[model samples]
Target: MSVVVKTSAIKTVRAVTFACLAFAVAFAAAPASAQDMELKIIAPAAPGGGWDQTARSIQQVLIAEKLARNAQVINIPGAGGTVGLAQFVTGAKGDGHQLMVNGFVMMGAILRNKSPVSLSQITPIARITEETQIMVVPANSPIKNAKDLAEAVKKDVAKVTFAGGSAGGVDHIMAALFVGAVGADASKVNYVAFSGGGESLAAILGGKVTAGISGVSEYEGQIKAGKLRAIGVTSPKRLPGVDVPTFKEQGIDLVLTNWRSVFAPPGLNDAQKKALGDVVAKMVKTNGWKEVLKAKGWDDAYLAGDDFAKFLTAEQARVTAVMKTVGLVK
Candidate 1:
């Protein structure tokens, strides 16, 4: 009986050893881990908006500088940015390999949609660039400067209808700020929302709307062509090669610069985060990035890691307050 038991135990041990070997072989035979990873640049708006432009700019620079051998810019636009953000939180969470390019609209969309995702859900990788808001009117319109536009609105609120890309988008918020500066009843002021900046530009130039608010970068070409008149820019300082004046200089006491930056999904390991941040820092140092910013009329304001995290928190609060004051939120 003892001999029989020993033989049975030996047979059991051999079976377990063979199973382990087979499992190891199968795992080893599996496809090699992907060396080229997908980094997603989620633009929260349709193509041609500032967010989309920023994504494309980053992609071009990253590839040109070899900061990323394999990368892609995906347009996940909707719900004034909430739809794309939902994907960012639920689908891209903890995906250190993916990156999203966003700006102040991220906050606007969250507040407007009451989204579950916030800045805290992602890793604030680095601030890429900042652009000023430019107030524009149709080329054929008589409105020419900030003072003329403000006086026209104050004289008759309905005389100038402001158009924006979305109800709570950066452009809309800038229009609100202008209304407040001019002491107009924001609710009473005529404001229209389009699907995107390109649409809003068309409405203004086609004479469907009296005025439009969008990033200076988006309307740079039209402004240069003399097809659109820039009444005021939201930057604190005048931009280079652009004759447009700042709202502050016009005594409007308003400055609302929009920024674009990169964010990775949350919970990256230290080594992985460092590697990603290093790549971003190298990209920022490149002349390619500088030239792109110059072309887009973006001012340099690069912040990474903890600094960016802090900035996001403050901006979140600031936007919430603005929205509340505008009666868009409680």
Candidate 2:
């Protein structure tokens, strides 16, 4: 009886040890999920721009939702996002934890500046938000409407300076288009390129430039406060709740919307890509992200995976064509 009892006790001890060993092996073999990894998002524009806003919003949602162990934003502003794009492509290859925010501005900057690193070098993650553009002058300025500004440009393209985001960006492109629409020289637009919305806003408010152009949300506050006067908005019709008049209604024949998106670094394998995409997909569906959209007045333009890739390709072509038409590029 004593020998049988001892043999059973030994078998029980062996079973416990095997279970613990199996648990350790399984835990060690499992890959770290996105929620367990720290994330770094690069805003390729200066602080107070649309890209910066988008990055911060994403960082907030990621941390709030516990979608990441931690998240942070790094700003690398210059050359219309080319400086940041170059660094991201070279430094963060194969890193699923790293991402960069960019959009239509970068497309024009790439062609105009002849950037060595292109968007094709990065992994397309998703297109997130879009917003219309606004053209404004200081509240005290004599330019009362789109027609007045068009007349000024027609009178002297060199004398009328327009301040906006980086050269060849959507702001610059819109200025050129507006000039062209008014029978002025598109190539001769006296545009002053700023690296950020803050700088451009200051120029407009200080009356340092004749006018300014930027995303509508960037200028909404001042427009409402009577600091800046919005002459026209590049929308087909007036925005639902906003009273800003459309360029079409004013007879200038212009409509353009700026889109913001996130891209991962190059060299990600299928698994890494899928994991990052999953994180972004989850973030977009959250109530926090929806609130961000509501506050910023950004449209929920979420398109993920291969669909985003295809959309990006088509966008490049469309932007290039528009740039050429406006004489921004050859």
Candidate 3:
């Protein structure tokens, strides 16, 4: 009877061990289910801006494709995204479900504001879209074209007030570059920064500012409505379906495009980073994401993995050099 009891105990132990190993193997083999993914995308700017628009587009596509169980966007607007960056770094550390929308604007903002939190703290996922910047004035303004605007800036750089999003953003950078390209003093550019696109649009429409610069899509509706007159677009050549002449065509040697990208929070391990990146990579390839790009007039600038990382590094160096040359930084 004692021997029988001992044999039964050994059989039970072996069976339990084998069952546990099988469960482990199955769990390891299965992919993460959609129900397990809850995404929170940070816009890092108020609504109606490029960052907000990008974040929402991502959210919409992710949900429509069932890539995520749920997704939401949180706006924290200030200091050209530094305010939001600080919050993201602290609040979302080690979280793979959290992503922040950022790009050239934040790059310049970090340098200009000397923000405590920088992009280095985040894991880059991908660069999604690129859009041209449109220079516009109120329809009733005297500046009829890019040339007229150039003359105005040359006449008085300090008096030609330009309204755009954030102090060190792409809009501000374009304004300064435009001034310099037109043989005016870039440092004296009267750039008035606004926290949101709506505020700057109001300022432009009310004629409070001399002109405005923003992404083409942001001002496209107003331009088409005859509320605003597009003077020049920062593209090497005229964009398809966009009637505005290129800055180069207007005899201004300037070309720039604002790119938007997504980043994961810090502290993600290799597997975590790869998992998040795979989701984004999948999203970008979907028809839903492509439709969003087409509707928004955004170019398919999708880049990912080590390629995107290398591009980001190069962009930082390029932006820093340009900012220094324009006197935006010493």
Write candidate 1's Cα lDDT for 61-101 as tens digits. 87787677667889987776677767887787555667788
Model 3 whole-model lDDT (C-alpha atoms)? 0.88
TM-score order, best first, reads 3, 1, 2
Compared with the true structure, what per-residue lDDT tens digits does model 3 show for residues 144-206?
A: 998998888888788899999767778888888898899987767788989768999999999
lDDT per prediction? Answer: 0.79, 0.88, 0.88
Which regions of candidate 3 are displaced past 4 Å? 1-36, 322-330
Give the Å error, residue 192, model 2.
Answer: 2.3
- What TM-scores do the predictions have? 0.81, 0.80, 0.82
lDDT by residue for model 2 (133-158), tens: 89999999999999999889999988
Candidate 2 lDDT trough over 10 residues, lowest sum: 25-34
Candidate 1 stretches greater than 4 Å from native: 1-38, 44-48, 139-142
TM-score for candidate 2, residues paired by index? 0.80
Q: Distance (Å) between predicted and true CA of 16, model 1? A: 19
Clashing pairs in 1: none
- lDDT of model 1 at position 68: 73
Q: Whose lDDT is higher: candidate 1's or candidate 2's?
A: 2
